[model samples]
Target: MTMTTDTRPRTAVQLQTNGMGDLVWHAEYFRCIAEQSQGGQVTVIAAPTTMARDLIGHEPWLREVIDFDRRPRNGRRGRHSGLDGLMRMGAELAPKRLDRMVMFSDHPGRAVIVCWRAGIRTKLGYGATWLQRLLLTKAPRIAMYDGPPVTGTYLDATAFAIAQGFCSAPLVPHINVRPDALARMRERLAAWSQPGFALSIGSSEPFKQWGAENFAELAARLARTGAGVLLVGGPSETALAQAITAGIASELRPQVLSLTDAPVADTVAAMSLMRACIGNDTGATNIAAAVGTPAWVLMGARPPLMHDPSRMKMLEGASLADISPAAVEAQVLAGLA
Candidate 1:
């Protein structure tokens, strides 16, 4: 088989900061860009978050992770505020001499302006706004309401490069787990008699979360089957984790563990160690799916397109409370099987 190849110029990708799930999908976009760039260095310009660093920092194809501060820095009247900050960012990036820039954000007019001021010749992004078209050298036609999943649209943004025979690798989110981290996760799970399942019971928004009682029921059921449950979430979810932990029967309580305060990287390592995951639509669930764990995500009112259904079992309803524990358990068992 003859493999086509194209060595493109250095590329930079500007990503959105909607949430961790969005970051995970954007990481996949980075992978596609890297693979498609041939040997060219690829840099990721994104919000400074541990999630962003952990997702793509270790990829060999990644040259750098530029921290793009979205907040009002240097005070209200400082040069780092508003349009001035965008210009400053452009000035800093100008030295890098980026050849082409890809914007994965919807309202990236400022970013497009930054790229233009930075002397980047080619700017590719998705948007129908006049400013988007006027600023971007290659603004592709996109329908936000009647389009594929957000991730799919992100992939489409790179269609020009792919068509030029620059990318052939399968488009999937890739996150490398450090060996030491993996070892620590294994040590932590050493007491488990069987494979463990990660249960994520928290969401950034309260409405996105399924009832804690539902998670407790699912945990108890999994415990009955001899599978240990690892409760995972951020610090804000400590209360919810405790509620689920306390709901488990006294005997089964030993099989459940909570790491709500663990670092994002450690959580990713732990997710990779788990046999599968069952959770509400959140960053942790997205990480589980991205790390190759079979994730059964509870999709409440959020659009199903926000997630990658092909990588996990998505149980969608008008609301998170509408999805019963039994339905989730069935999907979890199927994934484990």
Candidate 2:
């Protein structure tokens, strides 16, 4: 896509999510907007759990990342939920003087109103709801988004950006593994003989998990090949990581490393160091794909989601349990070869 020489305008993207995969997709869109706008950095308002700042803070084109804590936790109102919170957020944002604001999805409905309250004139979004359409100064026609949740918003956002002259073409989703992150992981893995393969084992839902037995078997197989298996996930997956490691043969257990404690950036760095990543369709898998690692996502319970074909490959089956370790091992080994 040819670069535009139009005057760069102050822009902000609003996405409400706690998921890291969603955050990565949105960050790619942010970079696209920045590149097309003559290298103008764009601000992002995202959910805190997404760690938008920590993940892409190193990017020169990222103006800032504002944490949007509107998701209800334990049935209680979030810090930025309800009428008072919205006003507070709007007041907080008013100082930025954003020329344009982009909102993804119709949920919360507060983002558009907040932008309006913050006096952001040029607003862009899907405008699925009547109120959202009324508030959005520029938006695509109302339509159902039938694509995968993780990548759909990014596609929609890029399409909207192009339509509004914010960008030229759709930018492929990518993650630039931070140098510091890489160094940190390198130091952490210095003891291991091989960077080997990574297993992204954590899933937001129970149905998405490929089960401990499957991952353990895959880890054992990889270890047999003299490959160190890195189990990547959040703290919640520690027990599962332990179980998978335990299930491995006693002699091969040391080859399996648990990286559930590593932060998002470090996890991405770890994936960068790996030969390939085989795991559930989760945020960690998305990170691996974005970092240009060959990610074999186990998509057994659902259809293949949108992903960069060059970096992500789907291994589909009737169910998560049905996707055998043997089949996955064969593909991963072949890919490495």
Candidate No. with top lDDT: 2
Candidate 2 per-residue lDDT, tens place, 128-208, comes to 677767767845554645676646666666666566565677666687988998999999999995958999999988888
Worst 10 residues of 2 by lDDT: 138-147
Per TM-score, the best of the predicted structures is 2
Each prediction's whole-model lDDT (CA): 0.74, 0.80
Off by over 4 Å in 1: 1-7, 36-39, 72-81, 138-170, 301-307
Candidate 1 residue 64 Cα shift, in angstroms, is: 1.2
| Per-residue lDDT of candidate 1, residues 1-337 (tens digit) | 4343655767898875646676776665576677656464588887664357666676787888887776533344434348878888899899987888877766878787788779888887765577777777754455444454535543554453344344553355546775666788788778874678899887776777787899999999989989889999888789989999889899999899998877687888999988888887677887888888878878766556434456677778777788888887786687666
